[model samples]
Target: MRSLLARLSLLLVAALVAGCGADASSAEFNGVRLEQPYGVPDVPLTDTSGASYSLKEDREDALTIVFFGYTHCPDYCPLVMGSLSAAMNHLSEEDRERVNVTFVTTDPARDDEQALRDYLDGYGSEFVGLTGDLERVVELAEPLHIYVADGAELPSGGRDLGGHTTATLAIGEEDEAVALWKQDTSALEYAEDIHALLADD
Candidate 1:
């Protein structure tokens, strides 16, 4: 699984390196800027391993990479996850240990514990996977300017194609919601921002 994801990451990285992303923001943090440091709520969620997850407590002083999407997502979800995995791999062991990569499901109905684990393991075992009520997830995204519009189900009985915030949010020291990269940002770009944010602290 790791090999497959690595290959995918390499391929995507090649294409994405030239373009920042569809909504790429090349600001100070190499991500779209937020007007202020938005306070993330203490939203409750269940991790893939059945562990409790509290956003407020978990990210209090950690440089966290937060992504809002579902496991079944065909394009943005896997691409972003693979990119993030590769970015982390590019980091030194010490720097990698200081960072937290988290994924919150926007379509909880289908992303159960096992499903979340299976998908996340393909990227990085250390990657945190959280799934819970869809409405609650949406509530959490609203403050971050993320919108998850529901997509219609396909006639072929394939899983519903849901749309979500494709941005990979970075919450750095003191738990302040800081930078974010869009779908077009490359893995290298993400790795750079992670290093930059850590240095700013």
Candidate 2:
């Protein structure tokens, strides 16, 4: 699983690097603005309320930022969420209203509705959380180039850390992903890029 995560991370880095050249001329974001924007994944999943939710059909904001991760992830997940939270803090009330953030769990077995809800509330009440069948989660992540896989089991009768891509995606008004941020991107950079995207929108 570690090897798979490493390989996926490398592939994501390469993809971002390639995307940089594709949109460099009209660069308007701190994050990589894709030349060929991705269409939002339309797969079905359950929201924190245990109700049906579809990313493509249910979004109500002009911009939606999505991240795939699990609550048990010891490092990257929390760091990215914290950065996003800080970025949200940097936005004006009106600007914040125009944006939506969604966290999709890669390990649904351990990330039930209540767990997801509790975890996300610490970040922001408005942040959405999605979890369901693992296969469905993988299907939802496929088009976005985010990988997800199970890991080995631990001695404590539990599973080891799972494999998943750490990149965060920014979907625009037309349900196309306009930009992506790497794990290391700072909160201020996200704030600036988000403000620019909103201005352009």
Winning candidate number (lDDT)? 2
Compose the digit string of candidate 2's lDDT tens values, residues 25-119: 54556788888998877898999998999989899999999998878878888999999999999999999999989999877888899999999
Clashing pairs in 1: 20-184, 21-184
lDDT of 2 at 88: 99
* Clash count (model 2, backbone only): 0
TM-score of each candidate?
Answer: 0.77, 0.80
| lDDT for each residue of candidate 1 in 1-201, tens digit (9 for 90 to 100) | 999999999989977875765435444456765668777777778888897887777653359899887777888888889999999988877778789789887778888889989989999998888887766776777776667544454343222435544777888766668877888788887888888878776
Report the Cα lDDT for candidate 1.
0.76
Which residue pairs clash within candidate 2? none
In candidate 1 the C-alpha lDDT for residue 1 amounts to 100
Q: Where does candidate 2 stray beyond 4 Å?
A: 1-28, 150-164
